[model samples]
Target: MADGPTINTIAERAGVSIASVSRVLNGLPTRQETVRKVMAAADELGYVRNAVARSLKSRRTHQVAFAMADVGNPAYLAMLREIQPVLKAAGYRLVLHSTDAVAADEIDVLHSLGERYVDGLIMSPLRVTEAHLRMLATARAPVVIIGSVPEGTRVDNVRADSRTGVRLAVDHLYALGRRRIAMINGPLDTVPGAARGAAYREALHDLGLPYDESLVQIGDFYRPEGARAVAALLDRVPDVDALMCANDLIALGALDVLRAAGKRVPEDVAVVGMDDTDLAAASWPSLTSVSLGSAERGKAAAELLLERLRGDAGEPRVVTVPPRLAVRASTAGPDYDRRQSGYDGEGGGK
Candidate 1:
């Protein structure tokens, strides 16, 4: 095996000082003669730049961290799928951190910015606490928060308006003439959970439908818990004509229990989920969903962090990805009252 070439070897071959060779190799402005000599020397020795040495000099790891609540959630995975490619294309490696929706764990991720292991970070905390605000105020590296932050918070932020998303789902249900609409939501303390809950009631009022307590079910954002919550909601509100779920997972769970109870989707109760994950289209009755632009948010967040890393000294920016309703078999089937609707089943365009 042959030994690899080094800067010192190039300096020796080029008959130049190490400093001159370093400046020329690092692309610092130098005399044309020095560039010619260095290029000739590098070509002869087949020299390749050392990334570790370059990073040490430039203080850039070319890596980015993305922290989310869950690794397996389809919504976060959609973001991950988009984020991975965008970072990769920009010559940055992605470091994944899952906080499991724990506030302390999320805070730990926020504090880890001091270590400076990566060039930047993109995080979606379930709940942004006072500690989060403190850490973000003095983050060691640039951060692109993928959730809501306070106004004037100096960080690149991308947030989803789940309230608008929930309203879209409810409006679609109302357009289909499904007045007895129910909601299956996650815990209300979380940002998305609370926004979705409030939006459902507001939507009901807008549609002139009474908001019934029996029609709302509280559950964690997972299959088992969603199923349990839907089962209970069904037991209490057996005549529910439609459902607006906080996320696709809960809506899928609603399908499971509704099928067991012998209610046909869209025919008996049209179901709508939020996040518009891939699972939405794959369900038995393809689930109608609210597209919160997960992919767009991820791509935008990566771009923002990369811009910051590139020495853009402007104040932090914010990108709000709009929501759209995606109608499918679950809400646009034979049972729907087409005569009374404004929109067809195919949700809105991208």
Candidate 2:
């Protein structure tokens, strides 16, 4: 293996630039044609990634790993989009892990720190458990958490204001003369789920609106389950005037069901969603949503992790990104004209 082919060799054989060869080797985005050509060349040369040797010689692999709950969720995708570029610019290759929102899987990722396969890690665990804290306390490498951890966790942390984000969306609905507003939320056991659900009730109380137990439905964070939850809510609360979805995906599902049910958005029922992802602008009538600064949080997390890698001897830092409201056509004011302000739904501005 000492005489193994180098990236330049693969580039020459593949008839591509060294950078292209590196990109393909690192699993970065590339055209299928380029990928195929590079793969064939590597196969013919019997070349493999030399991460082990690189780590041994440098004592710092110049590699980083990001572990999160779901790959398909736009919020996490937004984070990855931001995290990837920062690490890339800092000369760190990134490895990704999708832990399926499972605490055990997340704990396993934290424990894998001992292997030193990479220089550092960025993890966004769905639920923080005692096992997670135990692992963090003894982790061999620096770590950055993209979600909230308890006080005194002694790790760099980046958090979004979910409680305030949910409040922003609920207040928007209430200001629009929306009474009898219903909430379609995710599992209340998770961090974001519990925080948003409790914030919704608190917002209602502040508005003097009665908190109706019949107005809330719980489901997973994906589209299909969100659609079903909306369907059930529609059946139970036919006269519901507004909907507050926990995230953009669920709001998208609510929009689908509302359109199919002959309910005019912002007229029959105003809708608001959290996590102002790109899907919000792409949806019909556009979606009004709360922005928890996913991109900002990701960038901040990368910066913090890299700071530790650079031998920062400071105390652990905590960064809490502020939230904003993105008001689109979903909650268009009474005077808003769809014919005049029509959108193509191309850029939701996540």
Candidate 3:
């Protein structure tokens, strides 16, 4: 086996002392001539810096931890897609930890922040309780939250406007002349679920449509739970013409139930989902979804963390990403007109 070249070998080849080679490798300020010799010798010998030893000396790992509620969620995957590139460009490595949406696991992750394994942390805690607040209050390293933390808390936060997201879904249903729009939402105890539930009722009231308790079903934000919720909602309101799902997964489950019941999409019943995840595009008829800017939010959180690591030390900032509506085959029928009606040049002619 070929042995790797060591710093001593590079120092010998460059005609420099071992200390000078070490300084160059550690990114310490060195004379220009010495740095040039070290670089030339390193390139010739194919010398790679010992990162572990370097980190030990600098007391900085240049690694950041990303803790999420559930890595299986497509929205989290989208966030990862955005976060990975930004962190890489900023010279930081990413370490991912899945908490399985449990409060205990989240708290455990928060406690791990004191270990100093990572330079900073970006977390999306499912439920922010008093324990979570305490952890953030005295975090050793910088922390950037990906979801809503308490107001006036001294931590950078990147949040989604799910209230506006729900309004968009309901307004689209109302525009389609569907009044009995049922909601298949997740458990209301969670942050997103609670916000969406309140928004759904507010949107209904705004549209002059009565908020029917019987038409709302609470699920656990899983496929099976979403299917069960859809079944229950259908049983309670058989005349429901539209379904506004809490997230794309729930929307996919609603589609499954509707398909099993032999109901056509956007014809007999229109469906809308949130998150605009890949599942929405792969559905049978393709689901129309609201984009809660998961990718953007992740990028923003990463940027905030990087800024903090760079000693920005700015005041805690909250970034609210706007949601967009994506209309697709599931909400727009196959023969739906794509063009807007206006002057076609035959106007008022004899």
Candidate 4:
């Protein structure tokens, strides 16, 4: 194979020294005439800058790392899609790291900061721990968190208002005359699970509905776990008219269980989930869900990291993305009966 064009050839064509070409390619300060010459030469030679050498010289790889709890989750994939475009627009590449919701793996990424492999990091840890806090306290590069950190922590954070998301689901269920509402939620230790559980209780109190311990079941944030939780929930509260799940995966499990038990969706029981993931739409009776703004939150976290990389400000920022209720076929069945009662619609009225 023929050898590719070199910096020397580019410099000769541009009538400038190799050093000037290097400066321009590395985005370092250079004279205007030199920059113009380098660009013209690069265009003529069809030369691409050697990223490896440039990274070595400047100590910046022009890449950002994104560490997530669950790479397989559609919500996380949605966030990745949003984050990739924004980072690409800013002339940076992405490095994805799936931590499997493991604290050790997350901390490993943070420690990798000293290697200077990436300019910044955006992490979404499922659970915050002391080790996570310690890593953030002295992180080598700019770090933006997509989940909740400590209240007074000095870091940029973008969080979904999951509390509001849960409330939206509960309130929607109540409006549908679902007084016997049961919750099949994830474990209470995780950030989202804890926040959503608290919001469920608060929303019931606000709606003047009694909080029944018998109607709640805890599961891990997986389909099988959700199915088991629903099984337990139904065994105890057979009259439950509505089910609120902490996430789409759990809701899907609940749907499977309900169907297996010969129950009709929305007619016998209305089901709602959080996150508004693609699975919610693809289910047999498409699930109504609360949007936690996962994609928007990812974009915000990326923007915050970019701003820090550009040295825009010194203060830590907190961004909260609002949640919205997405109504679909699962919660739009005939049992609601509002349309027959002169309620003026099949859709849930505001």
Candidate 5:
């Protein structure tokens, strides 16, 4: 049997020297016309480079992996949308992994780095476990973490100042005269959940509001869990005037439950959410939310990984993307009723 196409085959078909084909394929500087001829011939001959052979010689797979809690989460999707373009422009392909925010799955991804299937990885783990720190300390390839990590960890870190993000939402709610504010939060074990819950308390304290244990309901970071938590909160504290949700998905659930219970948003109860994802703006009342800079964090993480892949041996860096509040109709707009009267009635948009 004949061997598959190689640099020699490409050169013979393009009427170029083997050295020229190698230069072109290796992405070394070459004449534009020569590169065009070699690439066209390779394409015509259905030539696909042997990635294993190339990696053995160059120690680079030219592929990057991005591991996140959930691929379908809009916040992570925002990051992926930014991470892909940046990596592609730098001559790399992306591989995605969903860890379900599980520590064991994340550790396995970190361990997979030793196999060298990818050049580097960008991971957004919800909980940074002790095993995570150990893996990050001696990872085989470059890693950029997209969430809070322990101080002085030797990896490029990108963080959303969600502590400040929660503060912004709470401050906005307080400014709107929401005194009996309740929090709809995710599990307290995760990094974001813990940080946001503490921030909520701090923000309330600063506003001269007491921290009421009954005002906080813990749930998972999903729409259904959010609905359950909100329903329970409503049942317990019927007079609660404001809700500071952990993320946009949960806030959406709050909207669903509030609408079901015949509550007028921003009138009977205002809702504020974190992670200002697209759903925040697309919901019936257009939820007000805190922008934790998911896209910016993704872009920054990719750039940092690229720098490491380029042989940058400098000190590990940390980038904290600032947070901003996106105010929409859910919290304070006069035209919400007119714009979304279709979903204003009981059990609407559920």
Candidate 6:
């Protein structure tokens, strides 16, 4: 055929029924003899299946979309590392969307579900608005949300316990005699920022430490903003003994300011960050941070979406991954081997 080989050509060459050729080409289970014959014929004919035609017939694009607040964020990058392989193995191509933590951008991504370009979606939104909830409730495709949603939201959800994560980091620093602990956090408008900001206060109160207003500085969750916040906090509370950074990026910024100020890590001041990302280990003193299981959350989201795509009609599920403290030289001092990785309290390496 001038248009190139098709399944019909393969069927004729293999002397098999068109149905057998279709099944073999679509990766469906078929008799070994039939599969071998179909494969050989298709190889000989240089036949290639048309993905668009296949999708139209099967009503599945075999593509999965992942929408996140920030692709460059190492925490989200960790999740991507896990999500890509899982989707790849399942024969689904991955489509990425970076929302930049903007509510409107996130809502647009949710609305795009009606396009049918991707079979399902996994979204991690920093701010979940009323519009977001409404769209999620009526999303056209199977959806897996990677952040906190109100109770009874009808979608598969994988959440990080940022509240507990902050507590773990705060408790760890408290145990190490960090009395003047300050929290450098993102804006309180976002979900993670709100959870972590409140958790830091709760942690300090539970430990009988006074919650000083000057000790809390809010900024965007990025290195430059984090550095600015830390610098501002130091100007106000120069004697702040410990810093609880909302994320690794913020913690790295804290390290930079501290180094420039001639303050020794875990000596003059101890620093702890959340989201024990790759940058944590790569930082100069090796950050002591909280592990909220970014990779695990991504994998769980992918699996949950896959289940939904497989026609699972059960109640929407929610998965919550626990947090662990990853102690390192940033808090444990120079005597602690920098080469040795930190561990979760339950004996798992970070």
Score every model by TM-score: 0.79, 0.80, 0.80, 0.79, 0.81, 0.81
What are the per-residue Cα lDDT tens digits for candidate 6 across 69-90?
8889999999999998988898
Window of ten residues with lowest summed lDDT in model 1: 334-343
Q: Against the correct fold, how does model 6 do in TM-score?
A: 0.81
Residue pairs that clash (backbone atoms under 3 angstroms), model 4: none
RMSD of each: 10.7, 7.8, 10.0, 9.6, 9.0, 9.6
Residue lDDT tens for model 5, 1-350 = 07767777888999999998786666555554675687668767766345323533465658899999998899999999999999999999898999899899999999867655578999999999999999999998999999999898888999999999999999999999889999999999999999999999999999999999999999989999999999999999999999999999999999999999999998999999999999998887899999999999999999999999999999999999999999989998646644455554555652
Evaluated at residue 348, the lDDT of candidate 6 is 66
Q: Per-residue lDDT of 251-304 in model 3, one digit per residue for the tens?
A: 989999999999988888899999999988777778899999999999999999
Stretches of candidate 6 off by over 4 Å are: 1-58, 338-350
* Candidate 2 residue-wise lDDT, 7-77, digit = tens: 88889999999998786666555554675677668767875335423333346557798998989899999
**C-alpha RMSD (angstroms) for model 5:** 9.0
Candidate 6, residue 35: Cα displacement in angstroms equals 33
Q: Which stretches of candidate 5 lie over 4 Å from their true place?
A: 1-57, 334-350
Q: How close is candidate 5 to the true structure, as a TM-score?
A: 0.81
Tens-digit per-residue lDDT, 12-46, candidate 1: 99999889877666555555467568766866776
Alpha-carbon error at 73 in model 5, in Å? 0.4
- The residue-by-residue lDDT of candidate 4 on 52-164, one tens digit each, is 23444465667888999889989999899999999999998898999989999999999867545578999999899999999999998999999888899999999998988
Against the reference, the lDDT scores of all candidates come to: 0.83, 0.85, 0.85, 0.85, 0.89, 0.87
Question: Which one is best on lDDT?
Answer: 5
Runs with alpha carbons beyond 4 Å of true place in candidate 1: 1-58, 334-350
